[model samples]
Target: MPDSDKLAIAAHLHVLLRRKTGRVTDTEWMAVNADYAAEVVRFARQRAQEDGVPELADWADRLDHAMHAVAPPAARRPLLDVATQAVRQRAVPAAPEPVPEAPRYVGGIR
Candidate 1:
């Protein structure tokens, strides 16, 4: 599955876990979503190996969004934890960093 999708799934689970009970850190997130975490790790490895699949640099971000937990960009421990767990498992494809389409130059030329 796509790295973002994997992360989304994991994040979804994380949110559920948090809502169902109490607070959780990155470590706890890993413990809770072991399977999805493994998937994220696997995806990262594939990208590192220069595999055919698209590389997704912001898999963590996607997951964070899915989890509905918005923190500073610097604070990505939760995302990392999920990816690490996934990598420990089987291969998971990561969509490469999106080369954003050029923004529409709506402003008048200087």
Candidate 2:
């Protein structure tokens, strides 16, 4: 799988855990820890399989490690302040758009 896909898997896992447990930082830290990589991958793969997204299972381990390498957002400020800033700035980045097909060449040279 591509690096972007791996990152997206990690991000998706984080979001799911946060929603399920109502914990953010702790959940993120757990997701990123190398020691739990296998377990994390297993859970993610199972979820993916259940969701009929088997492709996600292919790089689950790599995604977990990559996620571990990333630093979770700092929590220096209050949650309310952070949320307010996100609301104001639209902090959540949109997913990248798919690339369009390249034009076909006809002549060898102009």
Full-model lDDT for every candidate: 0.49, 0.60
15-60 per-residue lDDT for model 1 (tens digits)? 5434433434353454346455555445444453553322233443
Q: Candidate 2 residues 2-110, lDDT tens each?
A: 4565556666666664554343423444444555555666776776677765555655655666655544457256889878987978866789999999656757553
Query: What is the lDDT, from 0 to 100, of the residue 98 in candidate 1?
Result: 75
Cα-based TM-score, every candidate: 0.25, 0.33
Error of 2 at 65 (Å): 5.0
TM-score, cand. 2 vs. native: 0.33
Backbone clashes under 3 angstroms, per model: 14, 0
Best-fitting candidate, scored by lDDT = 2
Q: After superposition, how far is residue 13 of candidate 1 from its true place, in Å?
A: 0.6
lDDT of 2 at 103: 59
